[model samples]
Target: MKRVFVTVGTTSFDELIERVTTPEATQALKARGYQHLVLQVGRGSILPDSDSCHELTLEVFRFKDSIAEDIKCADLVISHAGAGSCLETLGAGKPLLVVVNDQLMNNHQLELADQLYQDAHLLYCTPSTLIETLKMMDLSVLSPFLPGKPKNFADFLDKALGVQ
Candidate 1:
């Protein structure tokens, strides 16, 4: 059985869980025989009220130091559509399913999600389409989207500053 690591935002696990209208998607995956490890890192405004499941294990307030290692060790990653999380997952060369936060009246996450989706880099899902998206994940089709360290903004700063 393959293992899937799901990491919600660092600052709103409770809000995330409350806003997540369809947690059955996660439950369905577990029912289908996948090992699901759900971790809530940092202090999130949202969180699940309970941590009971047949195949899902939920952890709250996990250490940041261990997040990278968890990402590296997981076969697939499920996370929110924060730039930091997206970039890190891409850097790890792992396929990711990103769920953007829509309740915040923000479009940045949605924009990022669209860009990554178009780039064939990460799978993006909105709350409405989450279940279908999860069902369609074919790990065999996953390829390394982002490789190695990303360019530092400072590297471009020189050109922007016109300093040769």
Candidate 2:
């Protein structure tokens, strides 16, 4: 079955969790041919009432040892804008939609998500814009995330430090 996996990583982003499970969002996902939605809700307080979401099967969990398997199994990934979660999903070569938590102080996530979006690696939006983004998103536009060579970082550091 085609699956869409939503993850909020280790923190709470209750808004994202709630938005994606709304009837409009579920209908949009269904229209796109997704059959199952599995959410890693983290510490979010709102667990969706699955019965209200028609024509889609929903699974919700708070935490897991690793979500690598889930990412691999997904046809698409909706994630919080945490660096780890974004890298993991992008590295898996899945179509990614990152939701930025505007409530946070400092809010570095927005910066990372913006750069990735500009790079065409993924799509991003605020929780309030999720449905519109979902309706408009086309996974075909994304470029596969090609990881840099292991030596690239070391080379950059060497150049910066002026080490021969």
Candidate 3:
């Protein structure tokens, strides 16, 4: 059985937590042999109040410094489109599904999420289609991540110094 870690960063994301803990979503996840569904709520307004939560090993927390430990243990990571979370998940080489929080001011997360999806670097889904997207995800198709910093620093320095 696999584990799933759903992290919403340090901001409230009640909508996301609610969606992931939904009966249908839980059922689908159980079908996929997920043994645990853990939520890093991060001040999120929603709590696991549904009876269906008992159907699985569901855990919720406000925040934790050891997110990488959870991410490392998880077979899959479902997260907000925040860059830190995206980079961490990708850097860990886990199959990630990012849902944009359009309500955030300026909504840059959507841009990052869409760009990563288009690049085949990660998976993206809206609040409405999260479960469906998860069911259809094929981790094999995800592009391997090589951080831009290490891979592009030389090119960046060359451009900055006007060297060939």
Candidate 4:
């Protein structure tokens, strides 16, 4: 049985949570043999009154001082497209499925998720395609996420301060 960790960063991403905890999604997840779902919802509003978590063992909370424990315990991760969440999940070598929040200004999360998917670093889906996307994947064979060398913090500092 696989454990899934869902994180939405430090802001409210109720919409993302709603999509995953929907009845359709629960059915699909159960069929896929997932046994547990742990959600780090931040300040999100949570699911609709009519929605339920189905038969799976469910653990959801508003926040955690550190998401490391939750991420480390999971077989799979479902995350918002924030860079921190995406990179952390990848660094941990966990299978990841990203859902970009289109409600953000300029659809910035969409850009991040799109680029990551293009690189084969992670799978991505929108709210409407969440269930369908999960249905199509073979998580057992997820590719390793290998990130490029990061720029030095000094480089960023210099660039930001216009100091060459």
Candidate 5:
């Protein structure tokens, strides 16, 4: 069975789950009989309203130390579009689906998502488009876009300072 790991708001797991209509999405996976699904709701308690929908396990407020290991073991990762999560998912060479927080006032995430998407580097979704995006995601089409390693902070400072 294929496994999917989903990480969302720590304190808002219940709210986030409530917002997701995964039953429809899971239907596709269910048809294939792939039922190993896990939700790691960091910093958030599991809501009673969330339905398991097949072989699904819900963990609330998981230890911070275990997150990387959990991500490493999963076949696919579903997470928020925070820069940290994006970088980690990319570093692991895992396919990712990022759902940006709409409540964020400035809409910076939209810009970031657009840039990443334009570069063909990451998959992203807003609340309005999440279901459609999930249905259409082509994991094979994603590829790593690693920036060249910088020599050092001092080198960067020297260049910025115009010092020979």
Candidate 6:
């Protein structure tokens, strides 16, 4: 069964969870040939009612030590616009759609998501736009996010610190 994994990482984004589990969203996914929906709901107070959707199988959980396995198995990943979640999903070569949480104060998530979107690494939207994005997104256009060298950060740090 093709799966779409939705992750909020360790932070809460109940809006995203609630939006994706809606009947409309579920039907959109089903129409796209996704049979399974797995969600890591994070600290969201909302518990998904999987029984409402008969067309697709739903799996919901709060948190995990690692979501690598879920990413590996997903045909698509819908995630919050956190750097870790975004990078991990893209690194796994999964099509990623990042949902920017607009409620946060001075949100950097939007900036990151927008940059990645511009680079064709992933698609991004707000919770309000998620349904439309899901229905219309063409996953074929996303480019694989090739990871940069780990030493790049170290070199940058060294340069900033004026170390030779």
The 10-residue segment with the lowest total lDDT in model 3 = 47-56
lDDT of each: 0.66, 0.90, 0.83, 0.80, 0.64, 0.90
lDDT of 6 at 66: 93
Candidate 5 total steric clashes: 4
TM-score of model 3 (CA atoms): 0.85
Q: For model 2, how does the per-residue alpha-carbon lDDT over 4-123 read when each residue is reduced to its tens digit?
A: 999999988899988999889988999999999999999999887666677699888899999999999999999988989999998888999998888874877667778899999999
* Tens digits of per-residue lDDT for model 3, 1-164: 58999999978888888888887788888888887888899987787743458547987788887799999999989999898899899989898988877577577667777788899988887778887876777778889887667648888888999997
Alpha-carbon TM-score of each model against the true structure: 0.70, 0.89, 0.85, 0.81, 0.73, 0.88
The weakest ten consecutive residues by lDDT in model 5 span 54-63
lDDT (10s digit) by residue, model 6, range 55-133: 7999989988999999999999999888888888888889999988888747776677789999999998899999999
Question: For candidate 2, which ten residues in a row score worst on lDDT?
Answer: 104-113
Q: Pick the candidate with the highest TM-score.
A: 2
Cα TM-score of candidate 2: 0.89
* lDDT of candidate model 6 versus the reference: 0.90
**So what's the TM-score on candidate 6?**
0.88
| lDDT, model 6, position 128 | 99
* Candidate 5 structure quality by residue, lDDT tens digits, 1-164: 56666777344434444444367666644443445666666666554333555434434344475577767877777777666666677678777777777776475656765677777787877766766776677777887868646668779899999999
Clash totals, every prediction = 11, 0, 0, 0, 4, 0
Order of the predicted models by TM-score, top scorer first: 2, 6, 3, 4, 5, 1
Tens digit per residue, CA lDDT, model 4, 1-164: 68989899989888878878877887788888888888888887773332256657788787778898888889889998888888889888888998877677476656766787887778877777888987787765557877565667778888999996
The TM-score obtained by model 5 is: 0.73
**Higher-TM-score candidate of 1 and 3:** 3
Tell me the tens digit of each residue's lDDT in model 1 across 6-103. Answer: 67755654444443324666666675566655555456654454455444655545447657877887777878777778888888887788876667
